[model samples]
Target: MAASYELKASARDRVGKGAARTLRREGLLPAVIYGDKKPALPITIPLKETTITLHKGGFLTHIGVIDVDGKKHQVIAKDFQLHPVRDDIIHVDFLRVSKGATLTIEIPVHFLNEEDCPGIKKGGVLNIVRHTVEMTVPADNIPESLEIDLAKAQPGDSLHISAVNLPEGCQPTITDRDFTIATIAAPAGMKETDEDETEEEAEGEAE
Candidate 1:
């Protein structure tokens, strides 16, 4: 699960493009918290702190408590606007997390035991179909990343979502069918060699 964090912010009375620009000049970024049947609260946080946290990865999935004056809001980052040139976060939107709320997020995928894979040891290429899987999970038990074991994977094997063992209370949003995750494909040269061999065998029979 992604780690939780606390950010200090001051409620901002002013809004609009001009007001946001002014806050940027003052080394603060404008952000808002909305949802869960509550009013949206606009606030400004230190630019340095926000930038550092965002670069740490999984910022959107990570829940945070934003302290505005004496009030704190438990929220998850929903969206953020970045400066086209500078890549600076100009504005951010956070959604309030109500009790028993489930979140939809794209969790990263990783492969384990690659060296032990029979396919990879035979010079087969690992072709990844999905680097991440979208899932709706309970906020309390969000998984960091999904791992697939390739220990017994053979060439031309298609690893599907059904192969992944998900955590309790976590479900993949894609439920219509068993989706493919990755495949161990035969090498390009090997494929060509097989084709050539097949042609040669056909010619031998014709002779």
Candidate 2:
């Protein structure tokens, strides 16, 4: 099941830089909802609610039920404007979504059972290259994350995007067959140094 977040908003009568600054000052964030053949609606949501929702893992891809002026709309966070200095959200943009629509989103990847992996036990370092991958899946079947178990991975073993088990109706957007997600590498010292030099040479030649 997909995770859902409830957000309450109210229509904003004023529109301008000054109005937006005022809203932020009053503990509200300005936002606009548009998509699915609906006109864009300007509104304001509580700062606390926005902060909490954004803090959730994979919040941008999570389906949100936004209540504005007593009407509920299903939407996905499309974009946001943040204050450069304060690093706070100053504005938000939400894209309305329908139940039958397929949404493309990036889902976080989690590695499990690392300690039990034979590679780690043999002084191998786990190198994770991709932390997230883009996927196109049903809105209702979106997964919060992708889990990979490395318990039996050996020193020379590698995990690719193709090896990831996705949820029903979910498909990785990447079609490359040889793309690696995680790999086991030799630990610090001579072996590691030699491996790094080899990798650097390979990279230099490729470039």
Candidate 3:
């Protein structure tokens, strides 16, 4: 499930370049939460707080409880803009969600057992084809990340989405085919001995 974070915000009466610029000058970030059949709620969050959360990776996929005027809104960051030159957030858009609503979100993939992977032990390189997978899941059951086990992977092995274990009620959005998630290939500049060893390893695995 996605972890939730709390953010304090205040209602904003105006929305425009002028108002946004003024808010930034005052150390606030202009934002909006809209969805679930409700009117868009224009708000502003403290620049410092926003910056801190932005630094904590995966803020976009994580659920957020935005408190505005003591009212809480369950949201997920849908979009955001960063300053072209400055290291700051300029604007953000959020989508309100109900606990039971299903949503499509891209969740990161975390590979495990690399040290024990047969391919890595034989000097193979891990090539990540998809760092994240888009999945449709219950809003309240979003997994933090999809785990891919590489314990049995060998060189020339291509890991596909079909090999992953998704959480209950979660499935990949791309259903046309079982897409490749990653691959273990022979490293660049392989020597003759390495090539022979890799082939022999593969032959052994086949048996």
Candidate 4:
């Protein structure tokens, strides 16, 4: 089951850059909630609670219950603005969701079976091309991470995005048939090639 977080929000009467900055100074983060046939509502949330919830992996993809003035609303973190220098969250955006709605989100990729991988045993290096992929899935069935097992992969072998085993009701947003997620390469041979190139360059300069 997907993880859930409960948050508290308050209606905001002030909007714009100055108001947002003022709220942040008071240890609050400005935010907005929209969707599900409702108009966008501006709100402010406690910075401490927002930071704690966001620290959880995949928190943005999980369902959130925002308590506003004693009323609860189901929403998901849709966007966030962060401080440029410190990278602290400055603002947030939430999207209201229904029970059966399908939402698209980017999920982290987890590489598994590395210890038993044939390529690594043969002194090959695994190159990860993508760390995440976008998927459209039922809100209730969002996966925390997509696992790709590389036990049987040999040097020069690659796993494409299509090869990933997704859970039921979850599908990748990318339709490209040849999108590679990871590849195993001959590390020793690549090093030898680099050495050879350096030697050739020296010889050319000597001539």
- List the candidate numbers ranked by lDDT, top first: 1, 3, 4, 2
Over 1-207, each residue of candidate 2 has an lDDT whose tens digit, in order, gives 243888999999899999998998899999999988889999899988898788765568888888998998889997888899988888889988897889888888899998898899988889998898888989887787889899888776789876778799998887766578899886666477778999999999999
Model 2 root mean square deviation, Cα atoms: 6.1
Q: Model 1, 6-96: lDDT tens per residue?
A: 7899999999999999999999999999988888989998888899889998787788888889787888898999999999999889888
In candidate 1, which residue ranges exceed 4 Å CA deviation?
Answer: 1-3, 196-207
Summed backbone clashes in each candidate are 0, 0, 0, 0
Q: Which stretches of candidate 2 lie over 4 Å from their true place?
A: 1-3, 188-207
- Cα TM-score of candidate 1: 0.86
| Model 4 TM-score on a 0 to 1 scale | 0.86
Give the alpha carbon lDDT tens digit for every residue of 26-62 in model 3: 9999999999989999999988887888789777788
Q: Model 4, which residues run further than 4 Å from truth? A: 1-3, 188-207
- The alpha-carbon RMSD values of the candidates against the true structure, listed in the order shown, are 2.6, 6.1, 4.7, 5.9
| Candidate 4 lDDT for residue 27 | 93
RMSD versus native structure for model 1: 2.6
- Tens digits of per-residue lDDT for model 4, 56-159: 76677888888998888888898888899999999989998888899998888999999999999988989999998888989888888899999899888888
- The lDDT of each candidate is 0.89, 0.86, 0.89, 0.88
Q: Residue 48 lDDT in model 1?
A: 88
Deviation from native of the Cα of residue 140 in model 3, angstroms = 1.1
Candidate 3, residue 88: CA error in Å? 1.4
N/CA/C clash count, model 2 = 0
